[model samples]
Target: MTDTRTDTRASAREILRTLVGRDDADFHEGQFEAISTLVDDRRRALVVQRTGWGKSAVYFVATLLLRRQGAGPTILVSPLLALMRDQVAAAARAGVRAVSINSSNAHEWAGVLEQLRRDEVDVLLVSPERLNNPSFRDEQLPALISRVGLLVVDEAHCISDWGHDFRPDYRRLRDLIATMPAGVPVLATTATANSRVVTDVAEQLAPAAAASASASAAGQPAGPGVVTIRGPLARASLRLGVLRLPDSRARLAWLLSHIDELPGSGIIYTLTVSAAEDTARLLREAGHAVRAYTGQTDTAEREESEGMLKRNEVKALVATSALGMGFDKPDLGFVLHLGAPSSPVAYYQQVGRAGRATENADVLLLPGIEDEAIWQYFATSSMPSEHKAEAVLGALGDAGGRPLSTPALEARVDLKRSPLELLLKVLDVDGAVRRVTGGWVSTGQPWVYDQVRYERIAAARLAEQQSMIDYERTTGCRMEFLQRALDDDTAVPCGRCDNCTAAWYPSDVAVAAASAAAASLDRVGVELEPRAQWPTGVASLGVDVRGNIPVGERLAAGRALARLTDLGWGGPLRDLFAVQAADAAASAAMTSACVRVLADWNWEERPAAVISMPSRRHPLLVASVARALSEAGRLPWLGSLDLVGGGPDGSSGGNSAYRLAAVWNRFEVGAELAAALAPFAGKPVLLVDDLADSRWTLTVAGRLLRRAGTSAVLPFTLALRS
Candidate 1:
């Protein structure tokens, strides 16, 4: 008789070859072992291999093997839409039927569910976020749990809050594992986990088996333990290097000068959306083909761009972290960063995109001086606040069991959108709340704020930030530094890296390149679209507003000299808003830019008057800019709007409801400004402010002015705060 091992190995190799569409395709070194543990031993396994490693192949091959032996279909919990799409295509090549139920394909969810019920699907993919979805959690998930042959969690490092990109949604997997049937093999795979994350995930993976082991004395069946297969994290094909520039300008120049010299079509990563869009535009203007990918990009647009990069149709994709993990492009030529990522682990994960299936790929970092400030700004919103948590809980409890939408809850809390969304996820995972069809409802479960855990995670993040700085400045082996950061003990100098050899990349920024880059960044003015619809739950906050504001009462589409995050005039604009800096008049250059904006505004009619908002933080700056624009356009200067009880703080950057509440009826259309505007009663008047955030301040002010008989309110600002 042919041995089972021989049969299994042969079957797996055949599937691998077919899946890759290569006659000689075979499993990587640890791939077969992971497959065997799953198929032969029926054991739980955690594979923490590097990016290009064949972790997906192991589970796919095993899934087929388990089905042949009469085991039920595999349930795969994936994290991204792109990943699910890729996995389904890969599974089909191996003759494994895969179906997914996610937000994008909601129209086809019924068919997919039907496929699952009929056992037509060999593998079912669902996002971790969907695991707690009320309908799925209440019905489909429980049925799937009873008969699932194998459970797989991709990008499993997210299961640990200690991981670099800890997602609270992934935490729901612990409860998932606990309720899983005994002896049902489980697989969790990731390319980015450090030792700490590995331990936490391993413990989480075996909770069911642990419980079964403890009950063995009472005749309950025992279960096997979790097995981990981790390998070296080094990429021999990657030549890593960091070139520090004096500022943003130099970095853009460096990218412009050397982009063509890079090996092949790849990625250009930026920290912010504006940077991605701006960089992509500059590259295109310089006669290179590129596209920008950010969290803000429409879903269909992102897919189209990803396909372009994969097919080598575009020279590069200027992107943010949205394109990070589970994106597979085996021969991706390079990964160039416009700014250093905040964490070393995240940096490694991004750069791992290159050299996966090639002999070599270039990886370069252009570290900017503004990188740290950007890092701090992004980090501030992630940590949950106890006070905010209590406020949200209190608001939910007072609802008397009715669900309150996120917008409605925002009216009752001081937290901003980003932080409030994060808090809701944390609460949902901790059993403190549940998300029903309408919105969120309290679970009435006891919740303890884990201050120490959050503190520890915060400390780890700081250490990682310092590590990223050290990585940038390190003269030692670059590959070794990254491997060590991921807690791989086998790390050693990769002779291919720049630090090991000489600098393989260009050192000097050509004068022409610098000049071109500067001219490219010399852009000014962005159209700021006016808010047409009022935020919901406004009346609850005593704002006396709901639904769409009448077009006659709305502020005309406005303009800003520049965005605070712009590559051109952003530096000067940022300096003006420094927290501790004394209020000062607008600088000459900024004043000139504002004049240029007015000259090019393309407004249908010139303003008959100028009005400034009451500024609590920068009265002089607002007054100066208003005065400058009025003098430049030769329009009447209608003194600042009056604040009744204490003008809207202008300092609070909360949600729309709160901002509107603070600004509503607070700006009085006093006689002084009204009298100045009376002469221009039938014409447009320019309303100026130092900054525009939430846009409600401008919205409320314009509504009042329109009601007081101004024909049109032309809103303008020094900068748009995104």
Candidate 2:
């Protein structure tokens, strides 16, 4: 018989060599075994290997081998559009035809659909989000599902709620796997999962494992189940280190002072979009070739930025997590985090981007005190609220089969856009709703709250955060610390880590660099544009307001001293607003910054008086700014807005519809304020507040001021929350 297994092995070797374009290319320890598991045994498997271990190579080779046997196209579900693009390009190198359908290429979806119909695509790459998309789900997915040769889930850790980055969309994969055709080999791969995450992913890969396969007395499975192949996760090329800089300025100064000494073009990760943009701008201003790649970057700009970095045209790409996951540049030099990620697993995954194909790569962390607060802001809202979930389901039920779009649902629900979308995904996965062609409709399926699971996930996250803090302070081998965090059994002290070796980096920041960085931080003031139109469906919230604001009811363009997320003044402002920080008079620096912002203001008409907004959290802070500005300009202090019906008690983070509803009719023309504004009837006035977020507060308060007889209300704030 000529040993069919040997012939198949030879064929797989050739495919791998062709895919990488090197005759010398070969599989790592478990790559070929995984391919054979899929190709020969036709069994499901999870590959928990580290980055650069050729996880993608196994799937591409298997897809080609199956195609040679007349199997239908493989379906590869990736989490990011960028990752999909990279995979499609990678597939091309293997001479395998691949097509993708995502938000970025809606115009080409029809062609892709046609290609799929013609059976021209060897692999179809789609985002996990696309699986729940109405058109894809209703019109295209069924046909594709019936014919899919193999199913591949990339970044599989996301399917586990215990993972650091648990996404609701990835939960849909379990349902997909459950309904897959019999005998189809499935593969799930990730590098960041710990023990819990791996176990969770394995269960999802075989959702009915307990019932479908029962071990006999011989300790063998009654049927085939998912097998996990894990390897040691130590990265030999990464020289891991941590620098405990005193403050944000010192970190930036160190970066400016020593960036040239780093090997090649690399990435500097930030915790926020604003931080990325600020860092990139500051670096570029200092004559460094860099670009900001954030979620806010448009598709074309993102492509250009990635290309610039890949071509080594830029020294770095200051980025948030948006640039992460499968962005391959083999010899990329360094990975530096401006602030630590909350989880060590997330940190490991991020730093894994570097030194993949190089002899040495640098990985460093600069921890910040503010990182915890940022982490809280994101983690607090990650799990869906039961109250909000009920509201969404009730709204959908009220529609009675009419597909309600996301915007319409937003109007009917109190949650914000991002959280609303997340809730919807969760509901869809829970069988409470179905995404149809138009939008979402109630499925009339009862959904449990899963309180226990949510609580456990939250607790796990806190522990992960504490582990990251320990990571920054650990004296043990840095690489070994990460390996143990991931539950690797083979962890040992890497000879190259900072703890294992000496401090191989410069620690002292130059005086000139520090001064320049401080000056850059001193740059302040952000222009605030007034909200022009009322939120759609506000009338449903019991407010009759609609359409664009009439000229008379609108506030003029305003200015803030800085954004709350700014690098320069943000720290002081954040401290001022901290929960435990007592309210006090404005600091001299703040008063001076306020005066400078006013000096830079080029409004068509200067304010003749000052009025403060009603403040529950920062009364003294707001009052001090108003009083200082009033004294500076020698203008009348018209007093603050009166609190009506206990004031707007809605929380700080609610969506626009509810925010407006909460404040509507809550403020009235206080007899004293109305009387004081009589003289400045048509003159502009500075309306001071502590912060500008959502802008709904400013809009509602400004409308009241305008209706109560005031000229252009120049809304000024100490910080603009972006």
Candidate 3:
């Protein structure tokens, strides 16, 4: 008995109401407003969004909106070839005619180009390298762009040197974009761009338009059009650790153990091809299904390796920084820095590779004493400041001011080896040069995003570098320093780190001083809490089944240590420190105790001293106690920075268990902690921390005491309270 017309009208109104009520399910009002302005103006715009912001979604929506309005074919310039493939795939999934043209294409590209010319495609993806191609510019681009209504530049930061993966060709994109149809809107997007890059992008793409706009405009050419979509780095779910290692062997061991123990897919990033291969080999030898990828690897190898990891055929991967530039796998669980990268931007990019699928991810940095020297090798060797400008100019001459191969330019320039590359990179940042094929070439003109302003914006970046140096030398409140640096005024000491938990807590003697009238408890207040219970005022949680001694046999050290950590002891004692008794004639009591009692003690240091303690409970106790010590902030000098374990000499060896005490008391270590950790620091001293179960966590704590001029190794006993 209801009217059909009225019922239909009511249903339509209800659908409209549902959309309005679910506005929160979409973006905030402000985001929609900003997007609407960009789409409506039909003018090219730059969108500065932080990582995890729905940057791609914004553009996707914009693309669809523009298409609906009868805009021409949308051209998307992606920095990475892989990213182009990913986008095209996504477009295809969305039922759009999307095709990519890159170096990989031989026959398919011709068809794609034909489709573009015929206006049969809705989107065409190209790499920046292809945009610089003469044939592309002379024959393909003009025709292709003529049909383009919207031009999109993804990861826009690649155009600036301040960006981690700065590409010389990106600077030239502005010039080529200029040749496109007038009034064709260009939308540039990136996850990370400082103020300088923002200004540079504005001037380069929309120069005249930005120039005419009001100077007081927010995120404008006079300023930066950045929409602060988010505020502050999130640290709640993030547990940061730093470990110092002594040698590469220990580092490898540390990596083996940590990678074995870490759950989910992980990436171990190295600086060079050789290191990547070596790391993968070591891990594989340890029975881990690990794959290696680097710039030298053929594209097929890279793809296969990536596929294996994605499909869970391999548990871990060792790769150079270039391995996953455009990769979109979302299930990444952990990121390990086999070596420190050249810049903070590099650090963010590599680490950002993790936790992409709304999953938890952890990052580990393992540095060694030689780390600085290696980085100095990376920074100062061939690219010394004095020779940079000359080499760049020479390369320009070699190219006859035309694009040329990198090898050819190196032959033409007569300077140090690396400075030429650095200079080229620098010029590329300045928009004075572009990298094409094997050579350097002029883009025919300068762009608005100049290097000078970029350098200025990159100033804060040095503070992070300085923090690394300070970590090498500092001895106090390493956790406090790290928290302050990463979170600024809101930083608080993270109890998870060695320095905050172990070094800062008061000694037993100090507590007596504070409570002079109280009688000393006979039990020493040691209470045994099950790992599941997580006792208050105790940072370590380990279960001692069978009373810390299984059948009174000394051989059960490794199993006992694992049990302790599983119970929540949370440290590196699954092996290194354990139960064994030393011979009295061969070693001093402490040394002998470490040998006979411990599982792996070498006696090269003792001068006629002997006697060893039985180690049935030593290793597990040491690890458990160390965990407790670190969490209580009694040994604040150790475990501050985010790193792997330190070696015997207190350098990070790339292993997790090897990260001993974080550098706490000193201002700088005189040498690099590892081949990589040193280069980031301008000086030697810095504060640091450790990741859980990393070798450096155990060794550095002991080693740093020596560095601070203390000769004795501090020991902790774990006897349950009566």
Candidate 4:
């Protein structure tokens, strides 16, 4: 046994040298132990260690050792494309031939499959979402599972519903684990799992016997047991701080004044896409090299941005949480947040991106007053209501094996596209629905909507939010507060935070810089890209629309004074449209801003007339803006379009098809408006509204005006909903 242990150590050392290209390198604390549990004992294990703790090294080393012993290849379930790319490269360095199957590389799947069949691949990296692919799940996955030597679930915290970044697709791993052959070791690893998430994940990774018993009760197969090894969550290299700014302008001023003082290329995280883009624009205009990274960034652009940041070509990537998790940069020098995240676990995870291999890194949070509102939006968006889930299941059941595309399903249900997609994923995980080649179909299985479970999750989320608020207010060690929120029992004052020591950062913003930032943020006009295609299956709703909308009927690219998510005007606009806020005329400041936006708008042709969308709630506000614009621009004020049938009580807010259907025939050009528009034939007309949410109202109203002899319709609104 001694000889065998010595030999194992030697082999691990060799693998480690190959992995890092350094002959003197060795495994970090607990890494070899985790490897031994997988390789020698053939037992499942969970490693909850800080970032850069050699978690990937453990799995790669184990894969190499197991392969040498003639075990089959390791299958790694990764969460992000960026992560998969990095893992593949890292595996290659260790002489482990790795191949990935993800959305971005569909064309290479054939070659990857060929390599897998030939046993030339040592490891295969795939996204958790790939587990639900019909063809792969039914055909490839079973064979791979039968022959696989080990399974690695990277970012394992995502498997838990209690995790900050819970994904329904990750839960589907239970089915795969339950069906795996006994004695095959499985490794689950993450850097961000707190005690609760760890416990939840461990329960899911319970021994095959327990899993079998539970599966038997649930009428499924058993899974494997897991041994968890958790390490200290504290990062000694991070110097944490939180600066409370007066408002968005101050936040921008602080960044502009101090971003260059940051150590190296880092990330500036924002809460919304608009904020990310706006911040990036501001930084760039101020002569800082930055780019926006958000969900809206295309795949190629995202890869380019990642590469630039890695090469230190850009100062920062102003981004949303889209840049979070599995983005590997060993020497990332700093992480600054424009606003606080909703949970401390999440905040810790994001800040963990910094100081991985550095002596010291700065982690700062410029907390904003608007953060809670943004948090509330995301929090509610993620949790599906029972009624919505029931509606989805009912729609699928009524389809009776006929695949229903998401748009078709959207028409049948009241949920919007994003929430509907999330609900479908949850249902798919529960085995009540299946995604096939065309779309989604019912599996004809009875599934319970676990209201109690959902409620518990929601309550936990609220607690996390409260904890984040406390973290901002704490006068003690900020890092300790974060660690404690993660249930880290060893959490203590690090004496490296602003509260523990003195403020290491400059707190004052120069007057000129503050004014410039304020002006940049306050100057709002986001181009509203017109919808070119009508939503599919709207014909089924008796709307008689399909395919691309007629070119002439579509409004040209339009403009809005601001996005409801923008940093500057967003706050006041949100209040203006608040549910309890009493309706009133547009404020003088808002009207003047709208006029300035109109004057600055470089439309192809200046508007010869103006028209308003009849508003039931904000009629006075909408009318005042139109009248203001008409007078300032010296354009004729065509009357507001008459509501033919009550206008569906003002856009209950669902999918595009439903939103369009709600206002399909709800408006008409009255005799006076039609006559007014006829005189402006072949001339541009400004279509004004209080707000633009779905843009369906704009689309329908624009079509009506264009058909009434206007040359083109230019849409302008007080705000655009993000």
Candidate 4, overall lDDT? Answer: 0.88
* Pairs clashing within candidate 2: none
Candidate 2 C-alpha error for residue 190, in Å? 0.8
- Tens-place lDDT digits, model 1, residues 421-444: 879989998899999989999989
Candidate 3, after superposition: displacement of residue 381 in Å?
Answer: 6.4
Candidate 2 residue runs with Cα over 4 Å from true position: 163-166, 208-223
Q: Which lDDT value does model 2 have at 369? A: 82
Worst 10 residues of 4 by lDDT: 213-222
Q: Tell me the tens digit of each residue's lDDT in model 2 across 458-548.
A: 8998999999999999999999999999988789999998899988888999898899899888777799999888888989989999889
What is the per-residue lDDT of model 3 for residues 126-185, given as tens digits with 9 covering 90 to 100? 887677665776688887777677888888877654543245567777676778776677
At residue 285, candidate 3 shows an lDDT of: 56
| Colliding residue pairs in candidate 4 | 206-224, 206-225, 207-224, 207-225, 212-222
Superposed by TM-score, candidate 1 places the C-alpha of residue 258 at a distance from the truth, in angstroms, of 1.6
RMSD of each candidate? 3.4, 2.5, 20.0, 3.5
Task: Pick out the ten consecutive residues of candidate 2 with the lowest summed lDDT.
Answer: 213-222
Deviation of model 1 at 158, angstroms = 0.7
